[model samples]
Target: MKRRKFLKNSSLSTAGIFSASLLASCETDKKPQVVNKMIKPIVIATWDVLNATNKAWQVLNNAGTALDAVEQGVMIEEADINNQSVGKGGRPDRDGNVTLDACIMDKDSNCGAVLYLKNIVHPISVARKVMEETPHVMLAGKGAELFAYQKGFKKENLLTEKSKAEWLEWKKTSKYQPVINIENHDTIGMLAIDSKGDIAGACTTSGMAYKIGGRVGDSPIIGAGLFVDNEVGGATATGVGEEVVRTVGSFLIVELMRQGKTPQEACEEGVKRIISKNNEKLDFQIGFIAINKKGETGGYCIQPGFTYRVYSEQGHINKTASSYISS
Candidate 1:
């Protein structure tokens, strides 16, 4: 009986130790859970509502960070000469040179850019370099190209045969079209949120067709074309370059959030503000897309029959063709 009782006591002690170890492990796991709950997740937004945002959304959903997603999405626009007015056969300046510009920013680091670049196959990469490597906020024209080349960026002949043909045709006909220049002011504006919950934005464009020699649009202008703040989200603008620049369109929309306006409200109000002040010819239109920290988004266009593409959670590469109903 004594031996049996001793064995029973030994078993009870072993079980008690195991229970204690299990309890300790459970507590260890709980600590991380508690910490994770305290961390805030990131949100993102882009212009063009669902259509443009969708590309970046897919990248983020695939575990890409917001910056990477934004660049990838912007590349889609750059390569799509047929779809976007920013590059390739879309348009060229009076001299028939394709001057391209792009800029990107990450709210997590407060990085920003303004690049007046030319002959760059990937202006977005140059903008990224400005945000990451240099102390300066902008690089312009040939200077920007030189900087990019120094960074080991290879030169790409941005002009396609189709683009050349268009320019040659323009030289031949040079028809003076009236107001409402439909041929100019179309590019891709994109923003996104990564799985890690960071916000980023990018804008890319080949400047308006028949623009002045050496003209650079607002695409590379940080506040005018693209602006991002992880704290607030991001915004990007498209349309008449001069109008967008003068309005400081993208930053203005984001700033509205600082004043307690929703993303959609901000975008609408920004467009309204521009329209109210500008007395210029009415043919050119303007628009913007944005996302806020809450994952709410907004898009607005000043021109009729304006539509945009978006990539998002509910929508993957959704191209929503919309009309600008006069308010």
Candidate 2:
């Protein structure tokens, strides 16, 4: 009988030990998995565009949102009186009016844009307000200006003395022919991914130099000049806006990425699409830059001399050539 009792007691003790060990193991397994915390943020912009990357990097480093970073970054170029392609100092239309076009997009698919908006100094900011405060996707011309005024944006003449002088010179001959990257570099498109992995993009321009009055380009049109999808990536365009608009270049890049192509491949495909569809080979430049959710970046252009700037923890102010540059 004592032996039987001893056997039973030992069995209970062993079972209890096993149960305790099992419980401890289960608790250990249930502990949350630690994710790598060293993922860096990314910023990319079309062309060098002055110190725009620095401005964007500052925002991302300070934990600001991606939307804020892109807007702040491109605004530097917009306000730069020397950059004839964008913002206040941008080249004017044939009518000598410096009209602006801009668009902003966020990961949530919210987007806003303004086209042929005159007198406003920062059309990008106006675009942001349109995205956030209004139900419409776009505002144009006088209506856009009125919205800017209501939003407390001051009206300022966008044309600088230098830009005006250039316009007057162009009027001497009234030559409408524009060289690639000289008179037709139409936008400063910026894309950024914040520390939290959210993506956003912005594209702003003064429209094509010496374009007819009231002409709008792809810069203010979502999916053409800019597109952002947090689940995939973001893309933006520069150069001839008409080709980009027809191909929906930026949107095509993101969708290509969704199909598992790398950023470079997607961008090249975008450029190729334009080549295939156009009746004649493009004589002007058209370029695209894209960044995936993984922070990979790539760009491609129809003509040579196209470059883009990137900022990240790995390095700041890195400039890279496009994968394909037309001969």
Candidate 3:
């Protein structure tokens, strides 16, 4: 009886030890869940693009990804005939061609762009396809249009009657200059952070009024017109494309944010960089808008009267950005 009792106790102890060891092993194998501590999802864009921001807010409010939000948001402006700087009604190049340039960057560093693409009203969508469907980052001119066609994009004349009439009148002077006034703002660049904390950006424009036919601006260039680091944040440039491209403006603001600058500070530094490079009269304008990883936003411009629109859980409003020239 004593031996049997001792054996029973030994078995129970062994079982208990085994259970404890198994529990320890399970505990060691389990990983802590990585929940994203998301701030309020926000959408920001250059100029008074409230409609576009609200469209983006619609996506974010529905838990859509940042990439989708930016794409859908900008498509509104692209289809709007009154917004001549962006899509269907954009002014023509010197040869009376209505060319569009656009670029999109998503969280994983994936990007796509189309430069000098004609006849496609929604170049932002085309850029997204170039990101997802193709191995190339950019397609240009006729090649871009062909790619759009192959991808089932409808080909329609992008030049509206109003734009064509304006182009015809512009031919009288044949004088070429980049216009900086609000009515003639050049690029519609947008950035967003989603509910999952992912970042994305898109920039689109018709090149400056009466620009050379073959000229491409910062709009379709990834680091120049728009840049998103995902882990850091995103930045975009509006106004003069050449100066922005020369300094890789958008990328610079993002890097500055990574190095601990607030979005506002980074944008101010960006405008300063452009100023440092140009000694000539600052007749042209440049605006840099930045959003950091925390959803903090800022905008700085080379000239006064620049504006930006913001939409978030807090609210939606249009605010004038402080300028290097004056406010």
The lDDT leader among the candidates is 3
lDDT scores in order: 0.70, 0.88, 0.91
Per-residue accuracy of model 1 over 78-145 as CA lDDT, tens digit each: 66656436644556677767778788887564454545466677777787887788897777788888
Model 2, 1-327: lDDT tens per residue? 699999999999999999999999998889686543555688999887649989999999999999999999998988888888888888889888999999999989999999999998899999999999999999999999999999999989888999999889988886665433444684799999998888999999998888888888889999999999989999999888888899898999999999999999999999989988875476677889999988899988877778899998866665655645445
lDDT score for residue 58 of model 2: 93
**Model 1, poorest ten-residue lDDT window?**
33-42
Better TM-score candidate (1, 3): 3
TM-score of 2: 0.86
Q: For all candidates, what are the clash counts? A: 15, 0, 0
User: TM-score, each model?
Assistant: 0.78, 0.86, 0.87
Q: What is candidate 3's lDDT per residue for 18-91, written digit by digit as tens?
A: 99999999999999987568677999999999899999999999999999999999999999999999999998
* Pairs in clash, predicted candidate 3: none
Please tell me which predicted candidate would have the highest TM-score against the true structure: 3
